[model samples]
Target: MSIDFLKKYFFGDVQSSSDVSSVAFQQSALRILLALTLCIFLVSEVHFLFTAGDYSFLAINSVYLAALIGLLYLSRRYEKATAILFLFTLVTASILLLTLSNEFHAEKYALISLYSLPLITRLLFTFKASIVAMVANLYPFYLITNNSWMGSAEFLDSANLLTSADALAGASIAPSFYFQMLTFVTLNIGLPLAVSRIIQTLESHAIKMKDLNQKLNSHYAMYEEFFENTGTPSLLCDQRGKVLKANQLCRHLLTGGIKKSLAHSNITDWLTPAGENSRFAWQSDMAECTLKSDSQTHINIRRASLTEHGHLVIHLENTTELKAIQQELESTQETNSRLAHFDVLTRLPNHRHFCQQVNQRLAEHDKHVTGAMFIIRISQFKLLNKQYGKDNANKVILSFAKTLTHKLSDQAVVGRLRGVKFSCFIPLSQTYLIQKNLSELIKSILPKQITVEGNKLNMEYQVGIAYYHTDGKNAEALLERCEMALEYSNSVERFSFYNNNLENKLIEEHTLGLSLSSAIKNKHITIWLQPQVNASGDICSFEALARWQHNGQYIPPPQFISIAENLGLLPLLAENLVRALVETLTDWQKEHIHTPIAFNLAGQELMNDGFFAFLMALVTDKPWLKDRLELEITETSPVMTHPLVHKRLRSLSQYGYSIAIDDFGTGQASLGQLVDIPANILKIDRRFVFPLPHDQRHVDIVKSTIQLAKSLDMKVIAEGIETKEQATLLIAMGCNTLQGYYYGKPSPMTDWTSHSNAKAKTLRMVY
Candidate 1:
């Protein structure tokens, strides 16, 4: 190690100094290079001093140069070595300076500045290494100064020994070199340290700005996505009311792929013309507008201005669906209103609306001359619908309206007030002409068959003309008198004008109709019993005939029945009859009247889905009632019009209720239907009885009907039996049950049961 160090330090050619410290090496190298350069400049200037033979300065300079070259070589190796090698280099440098007293004294005063290298080591290396370097640099100064080796003559003379006398004698370094050194310390060391801190601060700010830019981009991307995918159209505008951005929906609505950056188009164009003064204008600061487009679809536009971004956001929402829903709701409300005030099928004002219109007309009654009004009704409309169908019946009504329209003037108005019924208004000037025209028109129109669903319908219209005030201007009273006139027309088979005498007749009819409820409740609607004798002339059952009596006048069942069904009072009549028969049977059952009681079922009652169950429940818990209770439904009942009746009747039969088909030969039932129904008994119609015992066509039909019933396992009974001759003829022809005045005139339960005629007595007339 010493040999290499001597060669490296003395010869300035160290090749294997491996363990040198980087800071120590750099510090020593810098000092040595600075010393050598100064010596070179001094030697060049003082060649004459060398001629005077003062060679000590030359020797000292050579030593310093050698030390500097060794320091440079050590510095190269020391930067790669550990702190210990740097410490050794520091100690070795200190020892070398100690041996050369003159060279040490020349640099010994610089030891204080060199001590700062140890402070650099503490900043750049470990504390122990710094302390070692600090002591190594400072101890030489302490030794040279305290031991009196640092005096001016000896110390400066040692540094001067390497310089020629001629270089020192006349040449000068000038005072600026020291000043330049001071300026170099300030510019290089101080400025570079300050610059490094500034660069670090700028780099940290760059990193923060980069992170903030990333967050802003992320938020902007999210906002773009939300606006584009939302259902409503969205637009963003700048402060000048120019569109800056628009979402996909807004593009489709307003620009049609034109970029939102367009200047001319904006939210103002989307506003309805009617809403030009709307708040969509920036000056108005209004944010919303609702209007209809050219396509009649409704749209709602909403806007919000952003003061910070200096832009406005517009949202367009189509409200067409909401408007459609509102229209549908309004239509439903209108239908309910119509139902409350008008008839459903006719589309004409109902009784309710008619009364209101009449009252209104009465309020303005003094404004015009009195006019005559006509309440016209087609008397056979129900029978027509029953024979044909409702489709034909509706055509008949429409035909009547057409005829009345053609006959009356434009000033006159006709309205359908009830089913198969119409009312007409006319001025008194043309009353006679209107009445004559209406009469002739009805005569011409009523006879023609109306074709409906490929079926011909025959019907007749009955007109009841009532002059205003004379027939009572009040709606109810006038309607009553008009009905009386219609009743007269139907009886006479012609148009009937209301006269003073018809009021009494109308009073009588009203009295009869009003007493009907009481009569039904009291069982005064007589259950006239008629015996049905079997083929062997044995009584099998008795049919109950409903007869009405008002003020001692007997009214037929057919006359009251049609009215009862129309008034919605058929159910009450049915309930009363069922109760009366059940009450009568309670006594008869005690007397051992173990016979089936057959009653005629109304067409209206059979059509009702609830009527059968109601009757069944009324007879519930009376199991004895089942065998004797027979439901006689006519073939003319509107069963074919509503097919569900058969299913409902089949359900009743499944529960052990017996149902019978009455008037089989005269009705509209087809031959195919006669076999498929659930009835247990088939009654020969009264029309068959009308041509019986003589008419071959009637006999053939009756024979076929009987065969048809027998094939279906249904018992056949002949109705309208009058004479013993007809009975004997029917019995001989295998007709089983007979009912008419021949067995007994339709008598009440008490009279029929108590009379001697209740027995199987022979008839007065012989067969």
Candidate 2:
């Protein structure tokens, strides 16, 4: 047996004496047999010792050795080898008991052989062996007790004498019998009890082993389950790196079948060529790869080394969505860039991008034939803008750009340079063929009316062509020449080319904007008051006009008005004019002037809420002239933005203050708006007034406007009447009210008061 099995079997504290005793017992039994055999041999030799020749059969001792060999073999192979060994010892002890009793006439000392039975059983077997040992010891003792030696012992003890040899032998036998009883008690009772305790300990060990095995089996089952069901392509492998178990996910990931082994498949074979050498020895790295399958997918391959199992895990994260997101972001960025460089309303290249394009095109002019930049500007667009709001103005600009785009082909680069100013680049080779057609196309597109918010607006555009290498080459020079031509176009009736005279016009406008502030402060501005006549042929109000007295010359109102508006001096100028009017009207009222005096308000002034309050504060300070003071709002002023101004105007009107709509027909005013506006007087625009004498359309509009004003309890006044014929035509067209050069031109307060007093005498005579 192995040393481990031997160690388990010999778990006791035994001495060498006990071992030698066991060997002596075995030799004694063999010696007893030998003695029996010798006795038989002597009997055979002597031939006259005893008469039972059949006793020769009992002398053969080979059966004992044969049984010994058989028991030894059984002990080696039997599952309960301990019990079998104990049985063999018990049989040997029983044989000794029976042979000694029979041969020695049931001697009480024969029971001593049973003493070895308990030792043999307890050493080799468990509690079951102890029971067998008890049977062996007790059965022999019973037989010996019932033998004639026991009866003889009893009779000898009863006689209580040592006279006969039988009695003495019986007495000896009685002591021997008592000794056997003691040995039987020690072996059968005490040894069986000790063996039973040892068997309990062995049973405890067996229970503990069973519990340990159960725990091991449970843990094994749990690990088995985990390896089978783990969803992230799991693999359980042996120490040799051979796959022990593969989960469903792992099978699907690797080859879609569990029959094929993962051990022979190289991980690199499943990945794209880009990921062949991408493995990191220590940890992980991102690798973009395409799967080797029908699916066209990009994945980020990640690997983790599992050193415990000598395995590696590969996770493929599809990055197709991330790439799509990146692509969409790039597209959005490009679109935003395009919007920045191009006009949102017109969809044309804006000023900054146009300049860059021009520079790029010019840089490639080494072998070019020629190129020209035409700065196409809308002429008198400010008139359209003043008539309509910016919303309509934007629509007009869009329409103009579209027209320009249609006129020009791929060769031409067009851009919205600025407000109402567009640039067109034309190759010189095609400029000639396109020049006339381009001008005609611009005119055709411009004159057409554009409807915005149901307001049809007539607008116009002017083109100014400045050729490179002929007119100018550089961006600044070319733009300057084109702008000059645009200015020249404004002076003439139609589109015009840039000539040397264009500089003089720019110098004039520049000089005007620079000198205007000084001119207002230095009394260089002449004030003219236009009379407002009621239906009774009497002066109702007078509109104060600003005429620039420039170096002993007169600058027309249009020239200085545009300059003041552009330079942002219009508000200051308007304030000064209002203050001047208050002073002028205050003095006139002192002189018994009963006519109302009005100061013109610009659209820019109307945008300032404080401006109307300032005017009201001025009037409040001068209470005596309040009744004679009137405020004039031009139709061009953005009335929609000034709701408070309208309310204040209405309050002023309730206090007997008069309001007038100056340059009436020149702006966007409907009959509906006029009915609601706080106005007591309407001034017919000069254009309509000038054409009233000849044009029936002008006369009809004038008649309708006059009648409408009278119906609204407002007096209508016709302006710019430089001739009696125009005045007579206005008077005959049911428009008796008039204010122009024919009545008396706009003059200084001194000249105005003088002319007005003289005209009062004439009106008194006519009445």
Candidate 3:
């Protein structure tokens, strides 16, 4: 075999990268001893064959050689098993040598190896194994050496464990025996224990050294990687702030992209006066500093870390973008604040900001303080809008606002409350000062004329003033009180002060408006029929009237009608009235009553899209309704007077509705205005009919109205005939129909529909 192969077989490559030793020294020691013992036994067996003619000893040695070769073949793969078997092989061979020494009566030198068994066991294995080998060797040695054993003297005398001749003679045999016993104990127990302890200490120290070196290498690699490529702008510096090493970010930040090396430059030199105030320093806890460049670059020290070598490493962040963002945020906040408080068109403080300013001014004084808050309205603004267009009106208002701003004191809080209305808070803190502002100051400040589209328009205004203490307690209350007073002002008076009576009037109107809206929505307003009969008093038709019984008190028609018209709720009221009329006519038609029912329509109702569409849809769906449903327009509304106003009524006339001009004599209709009125019937108003048959002035007026209706080929119905005489006089005056309490007063439709025949018979006596 090659020397390398032989060496590998005897001792495999046992060095390992791991901390644990790859090859146990005990296994190696055991393998070497087994090889040596096998060779010696082979030689001894050959001697036995040649000298003693024992051929069987050679066969026995062949088995031992085979065992040695087989164990060596598996030793590298199974180290623990091979090592234990090899160790025991040596023990068994030693035992065999003793046996041969006793069997052949050979010298004591054959027992030499047995004495070294304890020391070999200690070197190859643990102390427990050494103790076992020591005991095993002792038992066999006693058997071969004791005096009482058969032929023990031949084995003891001839076998010299000393290996040197004449060391002990026959006379010194006992001393020689003592000497051999001493050698056995020392080799088996004493020498093995001493070497085992020394080996253990050296192995432990070697392990600690290896761990320290590995930790040092790991720390060095981590630092090297972090310092070179970390994203943060970082610098490695000494205590004096000299740049030792810098990351790529830091190199670009201070050294112009690393083109100029910063090996010896001080980082502190870049600091402006503000940044110079916070010098970088090392501390046990994480520290920070601020710095600025010469070019107004903002730099912030995020952290400063101390390295293992006691050097400082500072990480910086650029905050210039964040500073710009902060400034932009502040600008946006300021703009939003102004938008929240000021008017978009005029750039003036709105109601909310005006209230705040007023309260602020009032808070500067005590409870005794009193001033004036005026609710100023631009006079006839809506009229101006119709005359010159809304765009031109807006320009006029803008000019007025600019004039007020120039003339009013800075301390005054003047704000536009809503369209065409402005509020001015004059915090004079005295009654005389408020009067001065009112009598001469306001009139002189506002110009008498403001031009619109190069045309001079007269400037006029009305003011409603509310003073503190007597009027209200705060700005909100004061402004509300001023509005209450403004409701009482008219064009003649031009101004009014808040009083308790005005507040009561405002509350009454407010409550009535609410109740009127509810009544229209819920159909609570009852439609009453005032029977209009022919001259014979037979019920032919009915004039429908609206009535309301709210809170067990009757509300007059005139009171609620005016309220409905003013509140822009006339369409809703008219809708309810028409529904009542249609329902009554349908029920009467079922009873075979062919009388037509007429309900009044405001001039504005025909123009309202929702109400007009509803009327058209109803008529279209029930074509029979057009013959029964009659339309009455009050003459005072200018529907028959204005040419465009009667056009819608004429369309209705063509649709089979008998249009009537109601309240005829009272409408101020001239002959020219009466020429084009599309009327199928003319009803003389109650005012002219009330004094009929007695008052000569009304007699002539009613006669003339009836003659005018006759000439126009229209039927005449005299309204409000309360007495039998008035009804008779109206019937004699060419009146075809007469309606009044003389025949039947206004009652709910149920009363007339249930007893129409009986009521008509009773009303016939009046004629």
lDDT of 3 by residue, 1-767 (tens): 69877565556544533343424566566667667766776686667667866566566666777787777676657866776777667657656655553553333444556667677767666778778877877776686456434453454345444333343345545775677678666776677667667656656665775687688778888887877778788887787777788878887776545376878887766543243335543222333333434355666664466779878878777776887888898989978888889876777888999899889888887877667788888997898999999889888888888888788887788888889888888656454455545656667767678888789999888878888777888899999998988877788877778889888877887899899999899989988888888987687778888888888998988888878888988898898889877876776666566677888886778767788678777778888888878888877774445555667667676766788877776676545546666778888888888887889998999988888888889899887888888887777888998888888888886676566545533443223
TM-score of every model?
0.44, 0.46, 0.56
lDDT of 2 at 385: 77
For residues 274-345, write the lDDT of model 2, one tens digit per residue: 534554311243467655662455556555445564655554555667978888989799788988899888
- Model 1 alpha-carbon drift over 4 Å, by segment: 1-222, 226-234, 250-255, 258-303, 306-311, 314-368, 372-406, 414-423, 429-459, 462-767
Which of the predicted structures, 1 or 3, would earn the higher lDDT when compared with the native? 3
Question: Least lDDT summed over 10 consecutive residues: which range in candidate 2?
Answer: 11-20
lDDT (10s digit) by residue, model 1, range 126-175: 44555565455444444543434434544445655324434333334334
Q: Residue 579 CA error for candidate 3 (Å)?
A: 6.8
Residue 706, candidate 3: C-alpha displacement in angstroms: 9.9
Q: Number of the top candidate by lDDT? A: 3
Model 3's C-alpha root-mean-square deviation from the true structure amounts to 10.4
Error of 2 at 544 (Å): 2.6
